[model samples]
Target: MIRTLVISISSLFLCLFFTACVRDTDFDQAEDISLSPIMELDLIYFNLQASDFYDTINGTPILTLRDTTEIKFLDDSTLQESLKRADFYFKFTNSIPRSFQVDFEFLSEENNITYETGTAVEQGEVSTPVITEFTHIVEGEAISQLTLANKVVVSVTIPSSNENLQGTLNMKSKTTYFLEY
Candidate 1:
């Protein structure tokens, strides 16, 4: 008699479980879902010694130095479509006792400049390093221009440099992207 009672209880519970799972679930609500993701990534970094700006053979001081980095990720169609805005942050630590002008140029595959921005760095010494921070925001029509860039060219210019100059200049930078889909 106990065995029969157990079987009957089990059957009733199974029927109730099946009935509960039959409730209607809305699938159409998924169409209204939206996603917004913010991503930050390192863009560039470099360290420069004072000697790098001096010409050993010519015995002259170089006033400018330039570096270029490819940014192929910006060419992705999906990313271009989803990206709404971008913010670029650059920090410079200067121990060289000379002021600097730094320029960032976004370039296309054909070497045409798509966008450009710049900042000024104050003079500092090894005893006291000067920290300079810069931010560039891209929105509105500028977003389209930024998306077309496939390379970034950085140019650093110093007002005065000498072979005997001491200390170093360092730069760290990052970019933040805001996307909605």
Candidate 2:
């Protein structure tokens, strides 16, 4: 009986020792994630023709325009621009009966940048999207910025002949960049 008890205790100690020495190869600290949400989206006209119809932009009626642009990030904090205007298209039915507003957090910057291809990230790229939506009354078009660590989603709550709002438009590239200080 005593020999059996000693064997059992030794086995328990061996098990504990093995567990303590085990290495967690799969365990890792969570890396920082940057999600930029495009807020302050406006539903208005672009230059001459609306963005919805500029390219092969034909769809169900939509309330918002058809152009979408999001900056790419070098890291979670800094961002870089690859394309100035990302081609975005939206379509909707003329049957919806409710109105809606969209909001996205943007990067913080003092000035709003005018979009140009091969240009540096604009000030607005650092801002969050303001709350804006399409109504019976169309207004000037504006989408401020995409916030870090936020995913921007667009929705149309209105329905009309101009209802060319497209499906979910995501950023073409990761805008936020990181550089060790």
Candidate 3:
């Protein structure tokens, strides 16, 4: 009876020791990632007639255009982890001179956060191209899980004018995601 009790206690201790030594299969890791993506919309046109000025189409105001595009980040699994913060930048360029008001909204469904920014380019020399850039940083608890499905919406408004507004807009986004384990 004494030998059996001793053996049982030793086996229990050995089990506990092995269990304590086991490493976690999943663990958090902190990594910094930078992504650069470019998108272009060609042959964009905005024309508002005098008669249609009072009319609203699909809840959008007259002479206003809106576009929503998905923004990519780290891989799905990596994005599923916690994202401590991110620094975002956008570089906008046009093939021809354009006078319009533009706004950008970055939306994250998981976090229910929107980062909004905008810029306006007044009438410039037609012979010269226009380039605009802006940056936005999100830190602290504002940043949540970032995924590929995140959206970036672009809105442009062109006031009533006799001449039609037309140009190709190119957008480039650079993002640095700081992930936490």
- The numbered model that scores best in TM-score is 1
Residue-wise lDDT of candidate 1 within 1-181, one digit each (tens)? 9999999999899988887763577878799787989999999999999888899889998999999999999867887788899999999999999989999999989999999999999898988999999999998889888888889999999887788998889999999999988
Better of 1 and 3 by lDDT: 1
Which one wins on lDDT?
A: 1
lDDT per residue as tens, model 3, 81-128: 656566776665654344667786667655343566677745434355
Local distance difference test values of all predictions, in order: 0.91, 0.30, 0.55
Model 2, position 74: C-alpha lDDT score: 12
Question: Mind giving the per-residue lDDT tens digits that candidate 2 earns over 1-181?
Answer: 9999999999999999888864765444344343434323332222212233223455444554433334333113432222122223222222112333332222233323332122111111112322222222111232213222222322222233344422222222222112122
- Selected candidate, larger TM-score, 2 vs 3: 3
The Cα RMSD of model 2 versus the native structure comes to: 16.9
Question: After aligning candidate 1 to the native by TM-score, how far in Å is the CA of 102 from where it should be?
Answer: 0.7
Q: Which residue segments of model 1 deviate by more than 4 Å?
A: 1-31
Model 1's TM-score against the true structure: 0.83
- Higher-scoring candidate on lDDT, 1 or 2: 1
TM-score of model number 2: 0.23
Model 2 ranges with Cα > 4 A deviation: 18-24, 28-87, 90-112, 116-181
- Reference-based lDDT, residue 82, model 2: 24
